[model samples]
Target: MKAIQISQFGSNDVLTYTELVKPQLNPGEVLVKNRAAGVNPIDWKTCSGGGAAPFIGDLPFIPGWEFAGTIEAVADDVEEFKQGDEVFGFIRFPERAGCFAEYIAAPADQISLRPDGLSAEAAAGLGLAGLTAWQALFDKGNLQASQQVVILAGAGGVGHLAVQLAKWMGARVVATASTENHEFLKELGADLVVDYKNESILDHVNNVDLVIDGVGGEVGIDALNCVKPGGTLVTLPSVTKDEVIAAGKAMKVKVEPIRAEPNCDQLDRLAGLYADRKLVLQIADTIPLEDIGKAFDASRTGKVKGKLILTL
Candidate 1:
């Protein structure tokens, strides 16, 4: 099997396209021949010895969290899927799932079947971002119909999806992006789009029921002023979560930090939504697995409108 491996964590320079033995399945596991893998900010951060690094115990690690592929083999205890089944998953997050390779040994409990209408590219990019948006809006924020919600970094991987989902839930959506992305976000169902660069979100919108903070730090802290009393602000960046929470406390608003988890049920629901055109996953670019470094560089910019994918 060919994979991108890091003998030690540091930078994109540490990633090497190399050959290794294929992974063997454990109980209730399936071997997937990977078709595509999503490149997220966490992947680059983990490789740079920051995000999710502590959970990755040793050297010679493979870094990727989500994948779409076809089943090549299955363990005896796994009866839910068979060979040649198209599947996708966001699995074993904050731990090594080895998704940046041509093959992955995936637990059956963490994956879902990819519907015929969802392409491998869209299915691969949907898992982590989709689950993050779903969990943030419904689980953590408890958003309801007719409520108002604000999504920071609205054109981002998770933000873009969150905008649509919040709208689908019947919430009035307000999103923030640069001037260039305003129309794009409006098309995604945002009733309003604020140019965060030259304008103030606090000025245009207020009394929000939920704030999906994708860009943390000062931006997140400032948005606290917009949430109505008793409303929630779900902060996505772990690095700045504590400070944001402190700010939320000062303003008497609720703040929650989120780490997207694997739920096969949620994955299945998202797949169904994609098949129905109620949900869509955007791919900024797709690079070959051998060019993993290029994908990492693009993700590092933090300016990508959508997800980056690595084709296997």
Candidate 2:
């Protein structure tokens, strides 16, 4: 099988495309012949010795966690799927799942059947971002119908999906993006779009029931001002500053830092939304497996409006 492996953590140059032995399945696992893989910030961040790097044990590590593929084989304990089933999901997150390859041995419960009419690239892009948005809004923030919710970085991978999901839940959606992306977000069912570059998000929006902050740092802390008293602020990134926590406490707002996990149930729900055209998966670019280095370069630009995918 062909795979991209990093022998050392550094720049994109370290991601080497080479042949490797096919992975063997364990109990409750399935061997998938991957068609596409989602490129996330965590992929490059881990390569640069930041996000999830410490969880990777071996030197030559595969850095992808989300994929869409067909099941080639299944373990003895797996009965939910069979050979030739099309599937997609976030693999073992916060651990090595080896998704950026032609093949991946993933736990069967971590994936769900691919929705009808959804393409492999689109399915691959839906896993992490979709799950993150769904969990943040429904599970953490407890966003409800008719509630006003503000989503930061509305044009981003998670933000774009968050807007649609929030809208699907009947929440009034407000989003922050550049002026150029305001219309794009509005089309995704956002009730209001605030241009973060020229305007202040807090100035344009207030008394929100929930704030989903995909952008961390000072921006995330400042988002608390948009939330109403007793409302929740869900930060997608794993790392949150102490000041942000303190500020949320003082404001009587719930501050929750969320790390998206592998959940087949949530993926199934997202698939249904995609099939119904309620959720749209945006792909900024799709690179071949061998050109993963270029894909990483594009992801680091922080200018991509949607998810980047690696097509095998």
Clashes of each: 0, 0
| Candidate 2 pairs with clashing backbones | none
Per-residue CA lDDT of model 1 for 1-312, tens digit only, reads 899999887887899899988887888899999999988898899889888888888878889999999999999999999999999999883234489988999989999999999999888899999999999999999999999999999999999999999999999999999988888888889999999989999999888999999999999999999999889999999889999999998889999999999999999899988889998887889999999989888888878998898998
TM-score for every candidate vs. truth?
0.98, 0.96
Q: For model 2, what is the C-alpha lDDT against the true structure?
A: 0.88
Least accurate stretch of 10 residues (summed lDDT) in model 1?
89-98
Q: What is the lDDT for 16 in model 1?
A: 88
Give the per-residue lDDT of model 2 (tens digit) for 1-312: 999989998998898998988887888999999999999888999998988887888788988989999999999999999999999999774244489989899898899999668999999999988999999999999989999999989998999999999999999999989888888889989999988878888898888899998887789888898888889898876555456777798878889888788888899899998998899988898999899888888888776798999999
Best by TM-score: 1
- lDDT of every predicted structure (CA atoms): 0.92, 0.88
- For candidate 1, the TM-score is 0.98
Q: Which candidate is the best by lDDT?
A: 1
RMSD vs true structure, all candidates: 1.1, 1.5
